[model samples]
Target: MSETILEELFIKRSQQKRKASPLNYKERWFVLTQDKLSYYDYDLNKAKRKSLRGFVELEKIKCVETVQPEPNSPPERSYAFQVIYDEGPLYVFAKNDATRGEWIKKLKEKVRFNKDLIQKYHPCFWADGMWQCCQQQVKEAVGCKVLEHKNGVGFSSKNSSRRRPSRKPLPPTPEEEKPGCRPLPPQPPEEPSHSVGMTVIAEYGYTPVTPQDLELRKDEEYTILEMTDANWWKARDNTGREGYIPSNYVVNAGNGLERFDWYCKNMNRSQAENLLRTENKDGGFLVRDSSKAGKYTVSVFTKGGGESSGNSRHYNICTTQQGQFYLAEKHYFNSIPDLINYHQHNAAGMVSRLKYMVSNRAQPPSTAGLGYGIWEIDPLHLKTIRELGNGQFGVVKYGTWMGQHDVAIKMIKEGSMSEDDFIEEAKIMMKLRHENLVQLYGVCTKQRPIYIVTEFLCNGCLLTYLREGQTQHPTTIQLLEMCKDVTEGMAYLESQQYIHRDLAARNCLVDANGTVKVTDFGLSRYVLDDEYTSSAGSKFPIRWSPPEVLLFCRFSSKSDVWAYGVLMWEVYTMGSLPYQRLNNTEIADQVPRGLRLYRPQLANERIYSIMNRCWHDKPDERPTFQELVVIVQDLLYELQ
Candidate 1:
């Protein structure tokens, strides 16, 4: 490392560790060099009288990036940057953006060739034991958002992001039953390209779905051949290979709607409505996901005749066969935001013109875990927001994981289950991702009493939905969709070789959209794989149990199928208890002797027949979950 004739900003000098750090505003002279960064304290009276303070080897630097300033930070210190290395982050204050940029650009050049660069990084400052950006409590949690690098190496080992090899992503093909099943929706028109040939860069890497589909490489540019569908488009890569590509996966060279204002990627219909209504600006509007997947809805709120909040009108942003998006039938645009922009000026056919974007301050939903590889939650980070409820699980509370992510914490009174064993089992559970499963984030076993953390669904229990609220007067299609949600989750669990053991309406949760996800999946196994002991008694759910489960205690997918029948019975009867009139003692004795619940009034002959199949006396005779999904889907399609 040459030390002669180098700019002071080029080198940072000392590695001797010290405790009780000085304030960030303390100015120190940094010596910048090609391979070394050394900083020292110089006497104000004598320029040559300097003491070596601290330094970092540029080769060991992991990331060189700027951070969001804290509240009420001084202007000079506001241009701060962090130089992260094996030791941790080194915070340094710069005079302004120009100086900070210069230092960062030079530092990045020195460490560009360094191995193991992080892809995800927190943009906000880490303070008071929490990340100011995502509120993730873990100091070392993975970045809440993806950090892009021009050079392809963006994975974070600390955050557990791994560079993945290219693999084919088959285009979604919704299955259909034989002869009677509804035909698949018509594919978008293939002829006459919707948009004039335009170029786009892939934001995320993707493999070709079909031979006619082009591969999408991150940051790679391609020319549009045609717009086949809103979701899928035809494009030609640089090599002139023309094929279909997922539209949302690629963006115009400018990096698309990721940072685009007014587009809330994860905001559902209700949340958008609530935000728009709350703002109450006459033309207040926002874009969010539609109830139907892979579509968007424009929610606009307007006040009428002295109304305080006003009514919110939701319009499904429709797509034509040519792939043009439109709010009004005659007017169309190549992109959703383009439509939004146009509508902002002209109402055309809508009740109100698009205006305010309430999402300017809207926070994205927190990731399930504090960060990758963070299972053991530090007790300090967890805080009780409110008591959700107390019942079978014992004192379930609505709490914040790391004082950020909303989590339902189940406080258990008694359990001899070892933390080591549960931790091992939890690894698999955490990786089980399904839209229908109420995801188990992690367990708090650091202290005496164990706490279980799970994803919080806004609309409480499924039983409540069936009895009152939205599902109270659900139509045939609505009821079937809810049933389909449960079956899809159970089918996935069955495919994973995992059994819910206790499958009931009570054990399932409903989201704001009425989508039901199976909860407490594969969790009872920690207590004992085959044996589950709840706070009350043995966890062999009696009313739900088939003869084999009630008689032999033999739990399997088949037994779960039997429970599904009762769950279906509950759904059809609107959360009516099984054996409506009979007591448990009488029903238990009589059920084994071939007694069965009658069909619900909501269930017609066809639906009732399907429920009966699930209640077959022989376990093997019951329909597998996969079969049930198809049957229910087909029935729902017919109803729709």
Candidate 2:
């Protein structure tokens, strides 16, 4: 070895399989030095010389290149490469493309720098110890005689060409490489197809397609051209525009207007009026054009039911305000179809009748407030007792409402946010009602410093409770019970398709009975799907965030599950900060490299296993909140 002090550039802890047997793989810490690369069993305390697995001298290397997967090799090793040297080849696998590229680049640089030091380079072969191109059986075989070169001697161009004949064919010509140039694979025998007429119930509004395709729109009758797949129906629209539309967006024309059971986009103004009149004989209903470019609304009208009845008594199908479409001087809606949909369900109140109906059927009892319960609180009735705590946008105060009810009043700081934004957040909170969720009493929007009143939790934040309980030393059953409470609440939220983006022990509250209640919807979002992507430059809690959330700003229920795992760790460790030793930047760097927090001192093996499952690198692999609830409940029962 030369006296040069080789700097350690990169290090990754991974596993390496024995060349002789693919099944035999061992954990190794791969260290990449400037002059050489080696592997050793990882040590927590100090490096051990005896634990060295293997090393390849960079100077003796001839070439480094990525290799194709072998017939029987595991898929994980598909990105593997080989370091060909005079003695033999060093086979190694990387986790992904980027890592593999880095390894190859560094190794090739080293080989190029020490090109003169190479002796006789061996032909690529799968022999005594490893797999290669030139398959040989001898255990002690040296360089092949066919392409042997003297010490540091380069092969002549003529001899090199003769010894190594080009086996690969020439590249394809431009004409041959054009799109759809290759012959298509043989298709399976076609199945019998049925043709039918479908009414576009939902908007299949134009999505930009290839220049040859035409755009499809709502309410347009289409003849079924073909059934492309289970989810898509190939159809020719009334205008002779043929394309695929979502199967759910259309219904059979024979199903009739009753099949829609709500707003009919195709229904004309006269048709809507006649339908509403037939449905509710004497009851007044409103119909108006919809805010959407070509849509309408139908809403049921309740005489003298506006604000006096504690309900708007006006239900529309569409929610977005596009501009008022008037049915009468005093009655109007955003769209005419909305008005008809409201009449079909006979739903009342200011909220969208469609959402209201869905909530009544699909949601649990607590979340029935899908935009219905909102009231104005008299400021004089709320007596401020004391300041509870300050938040990002306001100060929460312990207060009494209506002289008797104790509440936490979140008073927004003047100019902190627009009144419309605050009202919108309050409306979302009002629709949520669960035993494990904080109850919103009402909002005092009429006053200057707006107040949002919610039920007060006696035990304060869960984080504070856990930290205080540390001295008392809660048992495993008690901690597991707390975790179960949080999981159950989160499960409900998940079922509602709600993502608690800021889920953490600090955001949760503990009641007098020691039950954990999920609170702080500051970052919560209601998404139709499991994932929600934040706009660029949004702030996030780094410590509790999953890898995807931290990296791509993509949030989902699974990311919340990841945070819940951290919260469970907080409970077991008595509210200690997660990744306490690493700062945000370090966490962002280390976590993607497979570093994770160790199990808390008090966490049992099973509990840690559940937490580990929650931290799976792939979001889909993480357990759902419902699953977590069951697992924790089982653990709690066992602890009892």
Candidate 3:
């Protein structure tokens, strides 16, 4: 055999051996493609190939025209070959550093092999979906065009162009009857009366009725009617026996429905509705009021259905005394009746509750002096200050501090309570201090109301900065640095055994120089404090909070780490809402079930790896704020 052939065989053998070795390479070249590019070890020269018994560790072949890996895949560890030729596409090795004689020989071999496979296997491109599935489809089918699906890759061709099935139309029913029943002969709709009647009605097993049979379903069924809405409905097959139907399918035959008794007795639905409207829109009924502004009930009811014969669900609504309705769990009213009653029955408690919510609902400041602070705010400042945002608490004003400095004044009308939540919040804030944390300048309690004084960030929030232009212009380095700042501040807090509880870009203020100042200690708590264990939307920033925090209502340094990961996501996406597409329960379920967001534009291998670590399903598995600081710092350095 020729010396060249012997040398070639030795090189090939060495390359094969290197594939199984765990040695690190200085750098690896990655080629751009229409499909994702994976790697396998190979040699393009006989000299290094024959000299070494393992891979030549193709180094120095970096800085390509375009190179992109999968969104959340491991870092590229091997080299890629980009062939340049006039002939039909082939995988001939480029003679980057090797001589023509050596390089051409290997290139020709690779080209020949690639050409042979071209009839069957095509080179993969970094497209919308997974790398492996695209290859599998290419191998199995003749005509394939890569398409991205939510979960993974979808390969399609002209042959697979059938239209999708259309949704079936809902069966017609009487307007007054259950929604899914068979249609009955057209009849005039009956007006329901509130008067109690001696007429007896019989109750029967579950029966499907149509809109046309509304009168029949009401008169023929049980006298005790169940009221529910159709728009916000959930369907279930009662223990496999009761037929499946939407929750709103059942309507009250009369006002005799007593399911809402528990809800009304405990909480003021008007107040609950106001609270729900301030934050969430998922559950609640809007009740019109002539004497008051508006009333809403947090209570959502499920009619008695399925196997449970005597089951009915009632929800409590919340609102402000000023007629603003909020929605809350019916239990929130029943369990914390004193708290609810105090806010509703007394004017002072109501005012104090509003006092803490000055900065933002997602980020209310720690109130040290309670409602007295709002009273201390100078009337001159209030007159000159412009209103920015309004909430149940009060209005956020852009005004001057000390009559000169540009600051924001948050004023709350004093309520009836002495100092319950305000005192606790104040104590928590007094213990926390960090460069990235917003400074609490002072409290004002000299006037008729109370107000809080804090250093006003000119840049507003990270949310506003990202929202100004057609598209956000934040640099990757800036985002990484912000992540580091957040972690650094959070690490200090974590060390002191305090949980920020709510960590989001909206809660963070950005200075003119781009420094991030974490604000809002209203929802924060001490690490070991066992005062509250309830999981309400108010207590937790549902979008930014971790699954453990929502499900267990338990927090630790790990919970803060989870919030930090969400904050990182918010920064990368230019202040997009976390879990924006998912519902509260969905957010809670997915995080613990390992579902997380992966942004393609900002998710480099290292950054994604860090995000994944912080977003682990297990709270214990999440890194500490200290560890997060290290990872973000390292990432910033790499980008620089």
Candidate 4:
């Protein structure tokens, strides 16, 4: 509602336009604003809008582009544009090419600040519930083409989504958060004559697996004319020759560094040091992006025999003018991963061998929305595997998305909470992505029962992990590292000016690799917000909340910090219930009276002091999450 950028009468297609053969299209008054794009049904006789049709938040938009005309298309709808948002696309047509160009330009400017902008999109029109170009039946499937920002160039194909045949229920494996490998596709058509093909660079060389398969040459650029399946793709080489190639052999030209377990895309020297030292491994190593433009650094941990231990060394992955990469002279390789792979086996010059490959990649954060811009997931793709836990909202279950991806589906009981408001609030929460936070994948709103899909952790809640986990005698360094993980995630929330409100061991989850992540964020819509009276009917986590939240119902980062202190107490006491034997009334009465949790026997002077600071009488007196991260990190370093 900031300012109206442009307004015009657009020939828009109905949401179910793809369901019919001829396609239903209509004329509507479209208004473009800084925050949203809205379309209205006009009263022709009155010369004004009769009713509001629909609107899309610009921030939720992933891609905006012109759609290529389908073969045997109508002339009036020839000049068309598409606005792709969470889960679906909005197709709008302009009268001429100039009008479409102007609207597209203004939209691009407004959405340039979006955090989840897509790099690819489908160019051709959709019909019969499928993409005409790619033949992908799923409306939310990823585009088969690449995107050029300025013109929004995209591609197409013969048939889309060569997915595997529906199989039996997959055994619930304990391999936490593991993404299953995908199968090759069915078929891909071709791109429109005016559109540019999706381009990629070959990362590995490959011999033809079949007579139909093309040989792949490393470091060569190829235009993807068609992506037939998940494995084989039809591509055109430099000489304008086309053939089939293995999809794994090539990567999005500049996105090769994205597919490694040892690579940390956004880690600095200090974070690298902290992670390596906290891991306390004799040969832990990780590759991180360098502060210098276009460079990378390798951080390794090694323990010197007997005399000294717990030492870390860092080296830059240097590159030569000829494009060869090397960690040391005369040991050049084709890529950075290759360089690290060599060092993982041989030290050659520096510290101990790059032994154990380390990274937080085991729990890579989920994208803002699922596949492409899909925020609202299709209920048809969700299958309830089993119940994990029961909560205030409803039961959370282990589930599969599209029979491939593992997801935690939280089924919201009908009429228990305000549905419309929760949906809108969820749209914002889905934007947050941090390694220490549980990710919200998407939501299912089309059916009678709504489901909230989120990232699934293997080991369940932290409270259970602390009590039920086999390792009863966790070392001081190990406890401090756990505290550090929760703090790092909280620190990110603090920086975003968002508050967790409810931070506790029960709310934190542990992954298979022993990493703890914060969950249940941004659920304040129907949750226990300031308006909650905490009567007998309402059940909430009062023990972990601060005095400010307990007495006045005021929530902020400081309140969350106070809860962190209590959560730490829970951790040290090995998951003992907070304020044991004391009721909620006693906690509400005693917490504001300056009664704080006592230090655990395991917590030494230094660790207790940090916890005490978080329980300061005044909210402002408590340390900020950023400051807490530093203090906890220092304690970790000392213990290590």
Pick the lDDT winner: 4
Shift in Å, residue 313, candidate 2: 54
lDDT of each: 0.67, 0.56, 0.41, 0.72
Q: Rank the candidates by lDDT, best first.
A: 4, 1, 2, 3
Residue range 1-640, candidate 1, lDDT tens digits: 4653234332221222344443334557777776577777766667652787676776557688888887997566577778876565677777678878877877776667664354446787766556788775544444544455512344332343222213322122222122332211111113223364887877566655236666777768888877634445778888888777766566675535643567666454445666776677988887876544356778889886768869888888876534678989899899887888899899898887886766633322323344444556766778888887775546888888655577888886564444456666775566566668887777788786778778888888888877885644666666676777888789878766577777889889987545688997655555543335542244666778788766766777778888888888888888888876876567668878998889789888777777777887876556667667656754553452
Q: Which stretches of candidate 3 lie over 4 Å from their true place?
A: 1-384, 391-393, 413-421, 424-432, 446-448, 469-472, 522-539
List the candidate 1 regions with Cα displacement exceeding 4 Å: 1-291, 296-318, 355-363, 380-395, 398-406, 415-420, 434-436, 456-460, 464-497, 509-517, 529-539, 546-574, 584-640
RMSD of each candidate relative to the true structure? 29.1, 26.9, 28.1, 22.7
What is candidate 2's CA lDDT for residue 375?
Answer: 52
> Among these predicted structures, which one has the highest TM-score?
4
Tell me how candidate 3 scores on lDDT.
0.41
Clash number for candidate 1: 18
> Model 3 TM-score?
0.40
The residue-by-residue lDDT of candidate 3 on 534-628, one tens digit each, is 22244456777666666777665677787788778877777677667777778777777767887636666666667766776766556566555
The weakest ten consecutive residues by lDDT in model 2 span 358-367
Which residue ranges in model 4 land beyond 4 Å of their true spot?
A: 1-365, 470-472, 528-540
- Candidate 4 displacement at residue 403 in angstroms: 1.1
Q: Please report how far candidate 3 places residue 212 from its true position, in Å.
A: 82
Model 1 RMSD vs true structure: 29.1
lDDT of 2 by residue, 1-640 (tens): 4343332222222222344444344445666665567777666466543366677666556566656666676667667666765444566667777878877776665555442232223444353454354342332222222223222234432233211112232122111112342222111112233455534443334342233333545555667766644334667766777766545445565533323434343222333333444443234444333322233455442323343322122322322222444433444565544445434454344333333221011111122211122357778878999988887547998988657567788887675555665465565456555556776666889977887778788789988888887327666666776777788678767765566778888888876546578886533332212232221112667778888877777777778888898888988999898888877788888887788879988987777877887887877556667656545644543343
User: C-alpha displacement of 529 in model 3, angstroms?
Assistant: 16
**Stronger candidate by lDDT (3 vs 4):** 4
